[model samples]
Target: MKTIHKIAFLMIMSTQLSFAQSSEDQKIMQLSKDKWQWMSDKNVETLAALFDEKSVFVHMGGSWGKQQEIDVIKNGGIWYKKATIHDVSVNIIDNTAIILTKMDLLAVVGGNEVTNPFIVTEVYIKKDGSWKLGSLSFTKTLSPSGK
Candidate 1:
């Protein structure tokens, strides 16, 4: 009887942990979506709050820091028009969260509109009980037509 009680207690704890993780993941996902919206609308103020001061952004064109990223977005250098998310997965380790999203992005860069599939990796660090984006990297993926 004691063994059965132990097993049940463990199961309950496991379920609770799952729920907690799920809630955390949902918050991160929503924040990611909000970031995309802000980028599309050129809302640099919100992006600045979300991004850490020393955050790194990697793109095919080049890599830059938070301020440069904000400038690029604000100046229409690399406008993120839309992101069609194909799949998104998140992994949390201690206070760090790694989010991988596979999506088709419609962007305007250098005054040219382009669509491409990419795997976007976002790293968030929990500081003072709040999450701040530390890094974002976009890797181009092969399209269905091999483009």
Candidate 2:
């Protein structure tokens, strides 16, 4: 009977820890939302604040660093319109978390407006008791025939 009780208690504690981690994940997701809003509005400073000093951006086409991301925004080359992101899920591993986000981004590129739906994976690493974005990878969801 004592062994059974010990096992049950451990199980309860493990569930509680998972709940705590989910709550923390909610906070991180909110930060991601805020960053997206800033990007849509071209609030470069606000967007920049969310990125870690060594953050890497693996965009749909290629890889870029912090400065490259910033430059795209500053030059008005990469802009989002009618931006919507949802169905976000977070997975935690010790001091690192992986956030998966679905995005519907509409923008004008070279005189033509385009909408690109994508799934983005963002890596958030805990540094100094705070979560900061370390890397991001995006996958295009458009059909092969450009549907």
- How many collisions per candidate? 0, 0
- Poorly placed runs, candidate 1 (over 4 Å): 144-147
Q: Pick the candidate with the highest lDDT.
A: 1
* Model 1 agreement with the true structure over 1-147: per-residue lDDT tens digits: 999999999999999999999999999988888888999999999999999998999999899999999999999999999988888889999999999888899999999999999989999999999999999999998962224
9-115 per-residue lDDT for model 2 (tens digits): 99999999988987998888888787777777888887677788899998766798887888787777777655677578888898998988887778755556888
Q: How close is candidate 1 to the true structure, as a TM-score?
A: 0.94
Q: What is the alpha-carbon lDDT for the whole of candidate 1?
A: 0.92
The TM-scores, one per candidate, come to 0.94, 0.81
Instruction: List candidate 2 segments past 4 Å from native.
Output: 1-8, 143-147
